[model samples]
Target: VSVCAEAFNPDDDDEEDTEPRVVYPKSDDQRARLQEACKDILLFKNLDQEQLYQILDAMFERKVEPTEHVIDQDDDGDNFYVIERGTYDIYVNKDGKPLLVGKYDNHGSFGELALMYNTPRAATIVATTEGALWGLDRGTFRRIIVKNNAKKRRTFETFIESVPLLKSLELSERMKIADVIGERSYQDNELIISQGDQADCFFIVESGEVKIMIKSKTQADQQEKTEVEIARCTKGQYFGELALVTNKPRAASAYAVGDVKCLVMDIQAFERLLGPCMDIMKRNIVNYEEQLVSLFGTSLDLENPGI
Candidate 1:
């Protein structure tokens, strides 16, 4: 099935209330409660106030009685919930038996991963007491958050079109890749990738710059082994594709020159969506490595590109 937000059409013809009415939290005190309830959710933690408001505006309150199944394993995830009151029991099937694996008390959240990835519920969550919940429906979450992410991704794809190695991809092919690529940020002086490490993710700098370096022999006058810079990368530049295609160690390290943001895709994503290009690079590995060395000298030694 195509990747998108979960289907959110609730059946209205059923006699009994299968779904509860949504009540939005108003007033700063209440929204503050909603914000506090979401403190532990890493996905929502980075969201700014405006973004948080969007989600809150689209949410509704759900009242549940004791022993009610708030979510069932393998069910299509319809909503993401935050506990405003009471507790819940989380269960997952193990060896054909339902096992209680976790619990969510006041201010706990469940069903976020499903909404983020459009996957089926992995665990069942049952209300353990008469309580209330704040929920964002699938459609609303997609409209407010997922759609914004999609827009950002398209912008990144446009930027990727100018990359040296990826420039050859057809617009449609690149668009496929845009769907799976993820973003990351780094603080100034932070390490982006280390030399001699097994590389699993390829990256393209989206903003700011990173310095390329290689570990060198300890300085004669100093006891420490300092990395020497060989190249500097800026927006629209990419690295680590060599390791993705060859499954080899990184030949050089990268450290953020300042605050940096990058578009990243893991090896699996590269292979699945952009696999054909992998072989092309592998077949001409020698020439490609040489070209890179020419582009970014290794340890200030052009001959020792270190690939």
Candidate 2:
């Protein structure tokens, strides 16, 4: 089946909702409003006009009432939401107390992580006032974003420019890196990388941003997952090098803060490219180790101990 057909007709066993609904067109006014709404959201703010339109087209319009629960904490997440109007209160149960984690206004979005990772919702999001929302389920969102090669290319180029590791690389090398990598798109609140999972590939942010969650064994009786803003990896910032280099499980979990596009480099491809420059690779690794030791008084174990 064609891509458009497949997008329009998703699941064969799904039952249609009999409730009457208002349909909005892909009109100039709607497009302009969507562009404005995207601007207020950090992730979508930087997307090109065409890309924004494509995303807007994929989403379904939703009108939520005040005090309505959009998503309850611990619920299975299947869709992501983008606020077109009004506000929401995001809360989480902490230490037996309900804590207000965040307040989201127009253009704000959430529920991406659950769709991406198949995890339960981390927080309960309730509409503070009557609102209009754009809902994009996982299937439609991925089909639109990830399968679009042209969009992926643009995202890759934008992301590569922002990565520190590739900043020193030549233009040719950057292009080559972009060519070698594969794209992955996530809805907001999705886990890009899970702590303790086997790391298979390194990632470069093409668009959007992710937050790192670190689990620390604080005391004999306490273990807590602390969310830290290690670095705001936006277009071009690369991560997962530590796992790729050491063959260790991911030390932290990275969650998408908004609609995200990333270029992932397979480990085998990375090693293959570096194979011809073994001597240069060794020198660079050694230099990096020396610099780390000088600054932090500790060195990374890059060499195989058995070898």
Candidate 3:
């Protein structure tokens, strides 16, 4: 069921609670199944192996009989559940009438929306058949998932704010960008993108530097193309957008200058979040072309003219 967000009120008492962490006993089979189920979840994608194991350890198993109301709409969220076996139906209370909105049977999960946003449970989940589920308590979910996600958002937001290209975006829009973008690290001299490849994503340097290069075929019969370094993108600078914006092949190759980390957003996100800045980006393309002319003196073979 679809639900909207509400302001999260962090409980002052929960902040200071020193109660020992709760860990439920699980058989080896149960642990293995939970691990497999969690592997494909977006919420757990950023978690390291150790953190993943911690989540597994904290989950308890619950067996439900047919017609059991596992979660009720409008109640405060307490546990997030991962389906292990059998079928369930999701119901939403619309205008005092219960409507069946969806169903889950496989390894699907629910109740996290409430926990993550501090809203009431928006849907009621009822067991259609006897089923088993692994549940993680509210405190554990916040400690592991909420805490790490907040830290990551703050880190990405800081780098995004430093980018001149995105300065025109509102704070809320920038925060939305931060939420969907992802991070990747590259070793020294690792190729981030190759010249002439189709552009699918844009990059923003989070740390270290990215070396920009362009390839040129000096002679008609030459089999090898000469690659020349054009620029170095330091922290907060961005690359790989020219091709994406122009809908052409990458104009230059990007390589990690050292141990480097970058924030990446796919073409879809670039168009969605940065759509308003298109005119600004188009203007900057001309400025980039001028810079290239000054650097080479003669025109380089930039079929698409981008970086």
Candidate 4:
């Protein structure tokens, strides 16, 4: 059975009614499976059980027979797919022929990038066996997922306002910076930045601590590396400002001292949203440099330790 977006979307007329609205239903096992699937997807990673349920409420079941095209390259995409039970071949065109490019089995998802940005589908996905899937449309994703992300970004914006690097920014400017920031989780002992890696992003500790390490001389060989802990970063502190201006290799490494979460912004977004702050960084660079050297030392890291 196959259906399009218009069929599963909640009726708009029910939203404003005084009566209590009943969300779409799912079985306990179905909800559990959906929640597990949502975790691997960055867009819905932060959703709580209720939010996950809301997504399930908006989604509808789809089934496909062997050799069916779930999505075709170059199509205007408005719906995202989450395969529940299936094996599939994903393809892309090369020299006017569809070339095998990827595969999707149970728990796989596709069409999300297009739904997120309303872009053309990048490849074709065809089922290799009988399959079951769930689909979410652009309207539902925008209404629920987009709004939820917006609210979360607003809270993060408020948090960044406390940083001296951005303290002077107006609420509007801070929000601009906040909107593009992405979230990542690090387990204990995970390296968040590595020494000598080209710096491309800045990070702010949102929760837990990240340890700063500097590379120092070791007994084995002058060329060999040893990490020496120098400082600890707690909530509200940000790093990598030197990279923002110098465009040099990072001088130190940072690792999650324990379970940690951070908000990150890549170089382009950093420059585009906070370009005016370059002047601020320049004036404060010396003081910030002094602080880091006094704390983390000169030789060190770029990437957070490990994946």
Whose TM-score is greatest here?
Answer: 3
Tell me which residue pairs clash in candidate 3: none
Poorest stretch of ten by lDDT in candidate 1: 9-18
Cα lDDT of model 3 by residue, 75-181, tens digit? 98899888888799889888899998667766567787678777788789999999888899987887777766676677677778888888999997787677557
Candidate 4 on 52-141: residue-level lDDT in tens? 766777776788999998889888776777778889887889999998855665665667545544457878999999988878877767
Cα lDDT tens digits for candidate 2, 157-251: 66676666666667655655554466679999998887778766677777888775544333531344444343456766656666656567776
Model 1 error, position 44 (Å): 9.4
For each candidate in turn, the TM-score is 0.48, 0.40, 0.57, 0.50
Highest lDDT against the true fold, candidate: 3
Off by over 4 Å in 2: 1-28, 40-51, 146-307
Give the per-residue Cα lDDT of candidate 4 at 72: 91
Q: Please, what are the lDDT tens digits per residue for candidate 1 over residues 76-191?
A: 88898878998888898899899986566665566755665677887889999998888889766655455455555556676778776677778766765665576789999998
Question: Against the unseen true structure, what C-alpha lDDT does each candidate score?
Answer: 0.69, 0.61, 0.79, 0.69
Clashing pairs in 1: 22-60, 23-60, 23-61
Task: List candidate 3 segments past 4 Å from native.
Answer: 5-45, 50-147, 220-222, 295-300
